[model samples]
Target: MSDADAPLSATPRTRLRRMSQKGRGDRGALFEVLRAGLVCHLGALVDGCPMVVPTVYGFDTTHLFLHGSVASRSLTTDAEVCVTVTVVDGLVLARSVFEHGVNYRSAMVYGTPRRVVDAEEKLYGLRLLTEHVAPGQWDYTRAPNGRELAATALLALPLAEASVKTRSGPPDDGVGPDAALGLWAGELPLVATWQQPLTDPALPATVAVPAHVAARAGTRADRS
Candidate 1:
């Protein structure tokens, strides 16, 4: 079976304990949430204290890749960690403040990340990471050389143990007593768009913006 066709199982650490109705079991859902997001919060224990770092990430069918400086303490630790990605679609305005919620898709993965050392795999993983943030960028930019690669660190975390949850649509207080108060209850959608690219002041005026970069103007930033 193909990696795309394989199913994702919720391990003990990933199983949803609250708001279970929003939990999604399909592997595709997890992939969609991850693909729609560019930033993720990595939670780990450093020196016996909880720490969460916001970082960029990339993922394939089976693994998620994270990169940082070689001296990063969080990436060097071998302990189990959690990575979470959330994309907020909108705000759910309800009649009652207590009933308000946000329209969002979120996913959490738990595991110990394995440090990547192979030169070929490291380059491949770095390419995936670069393309994930800016599509078509890998072809337009120069690749990293040996000295730069040696100073970088990469980690691979499996997607086998993960869970996804999503919430959308209008507010849920329509049938409650709060509805009689005549307050507006609906969704205020959030949309993210890319603005025009700005050229560096030091660059020569003859230098033109690349097609891949210019084409993204006014396009949705969150869509894969």
Candidate 2:
């Protein structure tokens, strides 16, 4: 990968003691981890106090974007922010209660976000955010009008200071005294799938589910 697209030199959750090996140092893996997730928690120090807020995030290969109101006390500032994304793949069922864990992927992105002011990039970023969630809705929906654009706030946080950590399969301690417990030990895999898209209540009676729209609901790891 090119340098800009490379993973962070450090793992994001170095301070979190559990599942440290899941913290990958490569940038590309982290991006893939983030892409697999829809929601993210944004952590930042507002006036030297820590704050954590959950929000929707969209990311391209190079940059991660978040949107909110311009009057947002936390997002509008020039201060640095920490963004984290997670995907729960499955539940690790261990033979013993103490050995249970989750099979998931998570990443934390750190950077001082650049407030997006360029009108073209703002619209483009919005499109990216739209497609990230509802892939085909951008072309079908009307473009943002002036008043709508005026009321929105967007921030671009560089996809840096990130890392990926994943856990899967069975408990790491399946071959000890726990193994003699006679309990069924294995992974209870959790699969995520997008259900069929629900039609808009305001949709015109003549409107039918387009192939582009219908395909989204059945989407899962099969597409990934």
Candidate 3:
């Protein structure tokens, strides 16, 4: 079985302390959250300064892959990094403002990312990244050329040390004193859907939109 298919063990860094009730120890939860989200925020220390950068990411069974231009300062370093992906599901409105919260599914991964150097792996990583963002687009478009590959940098971070947390349902004050207040106390669902594809104006009239791209229109962006 692939690493992704295997279970995950919580590390010291990944263990949740504050909201232990929401923490998920299973590997499947981590993989599910990562697969549903499109973008990830990468936190790292660069030149003694802390930086968090938002970037596109992809994953296989064992590792998460991040890619950017070779000139990008964030991708060039060997420092340890924290990657997080979150999907907001709804807004929890309570009787009190302080009790309000957001319903979300999130995952945090910690590790020192290794820069990908193998030609074969690099290409494979790129393909995974592309398909993650837009399924079936990789096979439809031309593969990356040598010049493009040389300019790009890919980094792989192990998915071993990670934490997954999720919050759902209604406000927590349903049985509390705040429930006495005559205010709305429920969840306002938040959803994202893809709109119809807009074709390039410069494209030939005969060049039609591919089925895979066209089919995604009006579908949930976070669908697994």
Q: Highest TM-score among the candidates is held by which one? A: 1
Span of ten consecutive residues with least summed lDDT in model 1: 1-10
Cα lDDT tens digits for candidate 3, 1-224: 65555656766888788989998777888988988899999998877888889999999878999999999888744678899999999999989998899999999998899999899999999998999989999999999989999999999998878889999999999999888877888999999999999999999999999999999999999984
Candidate 3 ranges with C-alpha deviation above 4 Å: 1-7
Query: Which structure is stronger by TM-score: 1 or 2?
Result: 1
| TM-score of every model versus the real structure | 0.97, 0.88, 0.96
Candidate 2 structure quality by residue, lDDT tens digits, 69-156: 8777668447878788888888888887888989888877778898888899999898998888777888988999888888788889
Using TM-score as the yardstick, the better of models 2 and 3 is 3
User: What are the per-residue Cα lDDT tens digits for candidate 1 across 1-224?
Assistant: 66544666857877789999999888888889988999999999999899898999988988999999998888844898999999999999999889999999999998899999999999989999999989999999899999999999999998989989999999988988888998888999998999999999999999999999999999988884
State the displacement of the C-alpha of residue 82, model 3, in Å, after optimal TM-score superposition.
0.4
Per-candidate Cα RMSD to the true structure, in Å, reads 1.2, 2.5, 1.5
Scored by lDDT, model 1 comes in at: 0.90
- Candidate 1: TM-score? 0.97
TM-score of 3: 0.96
Q: Predicted candidate 2: what Cα RMSD to the true structure?
A: 2.5
lDDT of 2 at 116: 85
Question: Residue-pair clashes per candidate, as listed?
Answer: 0, 3, 1
Of the candidates numbered 1 and 3, which has the greater TM-score value? 1
